[model samples]
Target: MIEPRLIDTGTARLRVMVEGAGPLVLMIHGYPEGWYSWRHQFAPLVAAGYTAAALDVRGYGGSDRPDAIEFYDMAAMVADVIGVADALQPDAPVILVGHDWGAPIVWYSALTHPARVAAVAGLSVPFTGVPTRPLGDIFRRAFTDRGRFFYQEWFRAPGPAEEEAERDVRGYLRRLYYAISGDAPPGSWPEKPAGATLLDGLVDPDPFPAWLTDGDLDHMVAELERSGFRGPLNRYRNHERDYAWAQAWQGQRIGQPALFIAGTRDPAAFGFGAYSDPLTVMRPHVPLVEGHMLDGCGHWTQEERPAEINRLLLDWLARPPLRL
Candidate 1:
């Protein structure tokens, strides 16, 4: 059974679901999601004799939500992860795993505090080079020729976006989730035209796989409904601040064993050419890295294919790293 506990990180109280035994493994969930996202992996990891903990990042689930936008900055986020590790294990490092936005936090943590991470794994989102250019420049370049992928612009917009999202949160969140998963309702986005806004592509009605059941969706919706979208949505707004903070580690390299898993159908992978040429950017920084592509999965790799994800994670954790 998974036990829920709160780890006080000085700045915020992180609500975490922990189970299993042995070395600590900390899982971080992505945007619009919480600790529950890793529900499937918790029990399996426990049964396999590993301690697993999934945290509701600050502002999501039961974690403390600070009203200031600066509270959600990358440095603050990294601090929370370290705080969780300090509060729980105190002496030992942890195997860090993250999905989507969670991936970057783990990446930053591993970079900022190398001694505290045993191994690192990222699902759906690969570690791109630290943000060298402005977030606006990156967005403009990524979406310049493709109008269909413009919804990222909305995410970068000011206060009104979060206000609107919080207005009819359930519906807004459902649409956002469906859009990113590429299961938007009918006529959401024509496959032929690649230049659609991210939100536009999310309206399709395709049925998601069993991994992301209606119950799982409801859990996410309920969390957002209670917390309101402001705090979580603000995570996207801090790109510029994050870029500045990451500059300190310009030449730092992540030497730990790293694993990256992506869904074959995940547009984010396709957008960045991670599948066709995985080594181009990521391999240079994270030398000991392995990439896996799940054919039928979407952006939600863990939820869409929990069994496969579990198998991969278990096998990776069981084996010794190349260096050791």
Candidate 2:
């Protein structure tokens, strides 16, 4: 791995880990995860002759964390992506790959600044185009209003979620990670009654899955402990704002080569009854696209199945649409 550094993106300074040197491939990680989440991909990406850079998404790890909730909005996040690309390779566009919240971040980066992003790919979450309404509202109707627990709804508030997670960072990470992973037993993430905290129904599996090592958990725990859950949880607080800002491109489509990957067992991949298939849901928004669903794979796509994810990514990068 190459040395990590912080790049000033005007709005904030983002910590980035970079490796190799060729056509740039910028990776963005999802909630409760830092650039370290993409640790499995850098070596393979470098070996395949592509410069790989993964960033902390402005809030987690070594990146600057803004106090205001609005600072973590979609527009600001997109700017960070462009800023990183410009800092790394000002002369050419870069490829983007994201997981979970990172998925939407990269999708919007390509949509809002097509000139800077040559192609885009997402894991665990598919591009659904510009939002007509906030997902929080949808979750409210589906889960909250019906007296069910929705993690995002719990995260929508400011202090409570942070306190709960921060009180026991390792325990929180352990339970959350295990609960959503494919390794968890069936019915691990069952719907809880309303008023339940994010950690209420989660399980802390003993002898944690082979995919996530003790070293990995220690690294993640250390970062979250230093940064606190405020910035990471703040990402969920901007759903309403994100929906409103996305209106500028209400009808816009990401007219770039795209790829998507997800675990078959991943709850986020099911689209919450909005769509049954990710490929079908993403096709309209991303015309030139390809997708793969790893059997029994969970939210941690690349980490859970690094070999398969690497093969899919390298194969996609080698395709005709994106020869770089």
Scored by lDDT, the top model is 2
Please state the error at residue 174 of candidate 2 in Å. Answer: 1.0
Q: Measure candidate 2: CA RMSD.
A: 0.9
**Model 2 global lDDT (CA atoms, 0 to 1):** 0.91
User: What is candidate 1's local distance difference test score?
Assistant: 0.78
Q: For residues 1-324, what per-residue lDDT tens digits would candidate 1 score against the true structure? A: 789999999989999999877888899998878998898898888888888999999989899988888899999999999999888788988889999889989988998899898789988777766767666567666655564344456666657566767776656656665554534333333343334333444442445434466777788778888887677877887878998999999877888889888876676655443246544568888988888888756677887778999999888888886221
- Candidate 1: misplaced stretches above 4 Å? 144-149, 182-201, 204-209, 271-276, 322-324
Which lDDT tens digits does candidate 2 get at residues 226-267? 998888888898989999999999989999999999998898
